[model samples]
Target chain A: MGNVPAKESPPNSGGRSRSSTYSGSGGGPFGPNGSSSSARRNTTSSAYHQSGGFLNGIANANDKRSKKTEEKDRLHRKHLLGLIVRYTENVDGGYLAPFGTYKSNLDYNCDIVRGLIMKRRLAPFYTPLQDFDESWTNEELIVILNQLPLHSIETAYSNEEEEDDIDNHKIHKSTNFYRRQEQKAKLKELMLQMKQIQKEEENKYLEIKSSSSVGQRSVELSSNDLLLRLYRNATECPICFLYYPENMNISRCCLQPICTECFVQIKRLDAHPPHDEEHNSRTNNDSEDLPHTLISEPAHCPYCASSEFGVTYEPSLDICTGFGGIKPGKFRSVDESNDDAIASSSTSPSPVSPRKAVKPRRKSSLAINTPGVISIDMIRPDWEAKLASARNKLARKAATASAIHASNLIMNADEDSYSPSDSRRNVGSSALSNVEQRMIEEALRLSLLDEEERRAKERREERK
Target chain B: MAALPKRIIKETERLVSDPVPGITAIPSEENLRYFEVTIEGPSSSPYAEGEFKLELYLPDDYPMCAPKVRFLTRIYHPNIDKLGRICLDVLKDNWSPALQIRTVLLSIQALLGAPNPDDPLANDVAEDWKKDEKRAIEVAREWTAKYAVKS
Candidate 1:
């Protein structure tokens, strides 16, 4: 058979000369019978020489293949190194996003490394390649790399490109457009996430609020958290120094929120002293007459009471008392009884003027022994009269006791030096001791005779 | 978020952990760039026994720029005004990148010990110091005893 003869021809000498001729003239074209002719030449050549020719062809093809592979490996290494350097150095003058590039490059390198490991090719350079997971395949790594946006990689390259000439401006502009679009997409995604989180927080707050009692609701309403937030958001109403909600009667001209009391003042500026009859009549026909009537007078602000006023329109019912003469319930006249009491109390006393009644009480205590001494007479007259009567009795008793004690002491003195006549003379000395001794003795004898005659006459009349 | 200036973050960390003696700086947690500091007066000066508080703020470009330092605790130094604003060359014109928080604090302590009366922030205090050193020192000591002492 032809196959048997061809198989045996490899051991012949004819094939050696044909193979030599073919090598000497590189890649010559053969005729249609070339296969048969070549097989016949191949059979003539010895088996050793034929085997040598086959070895030479295999070696030549391997050399070309190895050279091409080495060139490709060098290029891949250069690219990988460039990526590492750019990411590590952040070579975009600090403006570029190295993180994105790093992630992408990491994914790409992982694929290449993973492919080499799976094929057992990495064993030569990385000895433990067999231990790595086979599931970490190249295709999986490539998917991860593709997931990273293209603009990010372009950004890495553009940073280097910026150092080049202005002639590259068109390319730079196009890259910037792509970068902006990528940034916008990223920003939108972030915003959506943030909104979701905010919504969750708000729902949580609502849940807490709903579970609470009315008392708790009031407590929550008045809590410092809410009050502080309101205060921060609300500028002080220029009129009252208190915060007015934005829904209140804010002055359009000044952009200031005014209290209802101040809002009245602002609305009445045009109506001061009453407008002309013609103008009043024309404006009075409006159905909202309550606001106009209440705002007729340019009233003083209860707070500052400044007469200077301006105009305000679009006053809300909650904030303004009189809007188109429709008086809100909050603006009714305040009760003046408490105010009157306060005014009276404040005006009643002056530090400079002494109180008349208080002065008398102090003076009477100081002048206790003098007439009008006890205005205790004024406070309690009966008690004062009884006290005075008791004092008179005390004085009489003191006089009698003092007189009796004096007589007892005098009586106890020496009897011989104290004659009865001498005592009598002493008692009568003031009236009769101016004359001589005989005249004093005759006067004493006559005064004794007259006293005895009077006594005898009174005794005879009593016996009859 | 705007990226934190790396230089400021690094320097601030160092300043907090390894602070200068007689100076204590504590930045607000809510506002990392604003700091409150307390400086103890140096010994051998009229201001001794004093502990003055200061407010410092790192601007956005800090490290590239110096921080703004003000005396919140009133001081009687010639270089500090009644409003508690301090006038120091290092804070304004003579700032250098090499200078850090520790160095600035030391400079402030030195300023208190040896005031620059010729270039004064509080003119009255400076005038008193120039006219009568003893009186100025007495007043400074009195202020220290009254206002700055811990007790």
Candidate 2:
């Protein structure tokens, strides 16, 4: 009787090789133009490439094969096919899942996932000294990893395909009839809009150039502007990493613009007496912002580590787009900003006077007095206020599901009874859970409402 | 997350444009947080004339927290252990958010110049240095030549 050889289970390395055959279908005969159908064709070609193994020879042998042997061989092939399918399905899931949060269809919290990570951790190469039960599971590692601000993994499958999209613009050069027309039209429209914006900007610039008292004064002004722009473009604040448009505070040690805002913050941190012992504590408490990294300071410069760097504010702060900004030398001294306003008022022929900024914060005019005294207020930074702001930011970022649930319950509270938001007024301690924070906020709201209602009742009695 | 804080990017850019003397730091292509660093020992120190390889990793909360740094090259120093871990104030409790990559590396270079045996990570080396300073220096110089020199 002719007997077929029994097939063994494929090991991991063999499984990997088998799964890679999925990509083999990508470069098939039918897809001259790349399409999903080409991948399907590739799969068929790959299957065709694998000619029947020793089984065919065994079947062709000039002896009648026992019915039981034939049945066993058929069942073995079907089982092997099922295993291959499972392996391929997993490979596909890994490639398709969004990076970080690899939320596949499979239940991550299930025992199967726990078993898998356990197996990985138990491997001989893994750390041998760790307390096994206390250590984080693979699921926890994945969750924390996903929480980290990082990008998706570049799977071999997807990365190769994205490169294809770049050349999807083949229609612009080749005028290929097969290429989608709507996409090309959208691209053309986008290009036209960009050109239009460029043209408008050029025209506006020309008008400004023409209107600026043509000839000698204009040339002088333009040269001044060029120098200012060069300086502004080259110099960026070392602390904030923003270009110096205004209020440049150059450190005496490094001579780099460290920005007044950052310096002020540094000064505030300096004022907070150093908490020496807390540095080593690994507690997950947010209130202390995970223990301050700094110890004692005549607070050193971050760049040079020099304690002697005195901050010198630039004379003409850069043109500040907002509060705490200064675009220097753009109008001469800080005082020139106001003068330019006056100059424009005198020369401009337009009927509509440009609305002057209301509640302007920085008066470049005030900056004329150099080496302003470092008042106690300036040197002794407000540590509490800074901490409050920092605490609020942490609370916002760390909001969990429970916190939202608590907030939702508070939503049921009568809006009429709700007083002004006390949540906005004060920052809670970092140790409070999101749920606790929401509850505190609701309580604060209720108390405020009570006060308002009492005041309203008093007014009604007086009117009666 | 929040795009690598602008301050970090600025620090990295300046590192490339105007590299520090006797030191070089290049960020890894895969992860910007990881840096492959090379520092030349100070001329005055026992580590002088030797090039040290170090791996520096900026954590997610860098600037707010101290960078994780480990020496790759073997050396004989009181403050540095066999595991390549360093015992320095600036890299630990004394760290400030104000400190950057340049400042931290400078602090490490300074640590090499002034090996404080009293506050040492390698206890055995520290004991040797305290007992016989001259003999300890000899061992350090030998190790520098043996392990640190490329040739």
Candidate 3:
């Protein structure tokens, strides 16, 4: 009975190992070419190297057995990759599905929508501030849906590939040509299933609308009036304590409401500093340190503490995206429909401007690439670079201060460029005090060094 | 200091209006971030009769990070050190933004009722509690009477 020994392949080990690359100055700055896929590839190669070494350790293993074992390992690897692809699609689909669509697919979407509307809870295209559950005429639901941006629903379809597409890219990179073709075919099939489900949900929605007697009587309010009502009954974001319209961005993990302003501000702190093990092993004894590239941890949901903090936003149905039909920086008047809202959505530029008057919701910009969800990292794009530069500036200041004090005898050429007065000015109000403090410390350190050198010379002479 | 965030103001209002049953937290006039807190130890514990004082300060990144809380009243519990620093998960890694000051104070009161010797801040106290349970309880009671008692 020749049993294939299980290969210890942990998925998160890649994330853990890749932490140092982005974490600080150690792995250097992530240039334009350096992305997550390249980092992931490094992990795959390292995994292969480990297995190769394991195989080498078996001294008496015959070539036939080794080749057979390799075949088994390849199959095992293929199985693992398949699981990853399926898992990514499931999670992404689950998030993309309209809130409550997961209960029983397309069948219960209406019930979930009704339940959500009754609760006066925010959902994609179903944000109702006041409960009209008893008076929830099918016409009212249609009116509400029509008024709010139903175009954002189409935005989800475009984003369907999002993370799964990225996973497929990874799968393509990891596998052989045949495996790549196989995985691509499998992904196409999965995508078709998703599309079919989406179509069924749309059909269900149409059927619901056709059955309703919406045509018999005219809907009372215009889109603008509905927007005004939603504004009047705005929900306050807990973090910023600011009142936003009913169609506020919903936290992906806990479904708690958050305004775009506060949601973007929630960033991951650098919890894990860059480890020097890889750097030390790769380089010879060079005293100079590698520049640390700041890697940010995924922000946790403020309400739930669930990691990979992200938000799902459904664009508000009116002239401007929801939250009282107001953008964060630009406050638009209810009646005034201008180009300012479009200009203000500078964070996320969407080619498909649903309406010329409607300013796309900030998250809708992200909706194309990420689909339904926008992670904190995407919310504050290039945050890692900003953080790294900020840390570097602080480190440079500290380095100059220490260099001025410590290396009085052997000053580097760069020391000439550093002016104490310049640094003092940068230090602001405490400049004079800081200079005085540094001067005193410098004097003390110099005197101590001179004294130590003289004592060492005398000791040397005595030994001779 | 920048103007207080509205969330803090709102939280403070709620904390004052609906004060926790056995816990009271009053913000200082000069620094609203700093609070003077007192917790009446849980009933049926060694600290039942004692009134424990604690100082809690919310950092700039409040809610994102846990509040820095320290005991002003010395506690003789395995989880509490002589300096009154507590070894509690909520005060550290297990803290969630969903948790409020009210919830945290409630947790502290609950901690008094149950002293976890397995994870201790004060090693000697934990050892003493583990080795001789009755003696440890008596000592805790004596310390509570000596230090935590309100004159």
Candidate 4:
């Protein structure tokens, strides 16, 4: 189901128009002129100055509020959550400790993960914690803060930045480099704002905690205990967009959360017949002489587009021994043996297998099997068949070419060496007699021409 | 024909609830996946003040596949062809699931603000754009007035 129901629009309409209006009062992160292209263009120069002033104003002016202030706070929290989401896009570890090896970036990544806890997408966060009390808990308010819509801000700020430069965009192609730098700086500023907001919420929570004695144990839990609980919390998988426990499968490249169901669905695109590009490019119009064996490219990470896409699943220790499954830091491709370990031990049967339930048509011709990784053959079930056919095509092309030339070169002996069976047998090995070697070389040359002809024919058919 | 994904529903809700400025996307009543959209041209561009209409349809594998978008209101531009097929990278190969309808529409709006004649989808328009940018922009403005202006 790719479509969103239009009927759902009306109910959420109450706070819909508040974004543009909110940006109006205290010049948005952009500025006084609001969304005019010129104001946005000037932002590129004094970016930090405007963001700092606007963010500080919102931070300081907390008490004397309007009804719009609540909505504005919601928008601010959502934007902060968005910054965290974007920050984690390239981070290398799981939810609790997302900063992988670069200890230098630990403080930076920690702030992002801390912000991630407030995401409504997280399983434990599904129910609004605010309904229980008028004076909401720190976490509850933080979650409420995370609930505003930033789709408009994202479009206005990021997309417009690119558009504004479309005239001289090429000259400023260093935009990506600058954007990364800007993100890091912006992330730093937002983290400080988050800390301030959390501090205020913490003050309120402390007052509530002091007044209430019954629920002391829950409120007084140590930060370490909270971390442990966070480890046990359910994370929403970015690919399948479903929630799962913290130990959900992690993509090898960017460590983005993915479920096992979606992990197995990742497969390589139709394996290019080996040397397809090189041979095609080498002899522009001639595809007849190239070899026809097909070797599949490894599937890439959907999040990062990192090739040879694979995932490592760490079992939650609380469920079982947790030591039974593949340990972290292992780069095993998702294979059958591991698949069983994963399937049998998955915390719960997935509510819906996204592959079977939603996207059954995304199957590719090749599975993810590469040599040396004895992992799950989840996608590349027919790799052997594909390789065999490629061998068959090579043998046939060799035999036909040898048959054409062998009789002219060395009568009976070469004809025997060039025989279909001999060519077929020798296609798999390199050891050959002098005359047979020459015949095969000649055959290979002719085979390249044959491959070119076949491809050209296919191209013509494709065009038609 | 399948039930709508939650992602689409959420995206739809936000697209309406917190709509992008100068851009409005309303899902069709008949088919939840189909949306009627209008992007007001950027203020400084040839398409300024023009409310260009576009039809957006999410295929079975949206976010995996890009939403199928085409211009409904015609105007002169280099990157948009006569059939309303837009020649933008994000609309085709560069699409990521992270991108949403708002981003795509914003991109279209941006494309209008800055048409790259070098990468022309409408060859004759692009040629004219390169030969005489002033005249080409004038024609774009004329087309905007003639066809894209909403009654």
| Predicted complexes: DockQ each | 0.03, 0.16, 0.07, 0.02
Q: Per-residue alpha-carbon lDDT of model 1 for A328-415, expressed as tens digits?
A: 2123213244234333544332122111122211111122233321111121112322333333323332333333334434444433
Interface RMSD measured for model 2: 16.4
Ranking by DockQ: 2, 3, 1, 4
Model with the higher DockQ, candidate 1 or 3: 3
Deviation of model 4 at A277, angstroms:
14
Candidate 1, position A354, lDDT: 17
> Candidate 4, residues B102-122: lDDT per residue as tens digits?
889999999998898877777
Interface Cα root-mean-square deviation for all models:
41.3, 16.4, 17.6, 14.3
| Worst ten in a row by lDDT for model 3 chain A | A1-10
* Candidate 4 chain A weakest lDDT stretch, 10 residues: A99-108
Candidate 2 B-chain TM-score: 0.96
* Candidate 1 local lDDT, B43-114, one digit each (tens): 989889899877766543344345667676777888888767666877754454345666778889888888
lDDT string, candidate 3, A1-464, tens digits: 00100111111223212222212221123321247546755643443343443335333334543554455445444332221111012110111123210111121123333233222232323222222232333334335534432112332233222122222223113223334456556555654555455556455545544444455222212232333334434576666454545567778767788764455456666433354233213342222233354344677787877778777655434433322233321323344322343334323322222332355545322232355576766534445545554444333323434534344422332354456776634544354345445444533443344334334534443543
Tens digit of lDDT per residue, candidate 2, span B1-151? 2245556666899899988998889977655666788888899988999999887766544554577676889989998887677778877656766678998899899999999898777889999999999999989999999889853
On TM-score, the stronger of 1 and 2 is 2
Model 2, runs deviating above 4 Å? A1-234, A250-256, A264-464, B13-17, B93-100, B149-151
Model 4 stretches with alpha carbons more than 4 Å out: A1-232, A269-300, A306-308, A321-464
Candidate 4 TM-score versus the reference: 0.41
The candidate that achieves the highest TM-score relative to the unseen native structure: 3
Better candidate by lDDT, 2 or 4: 4
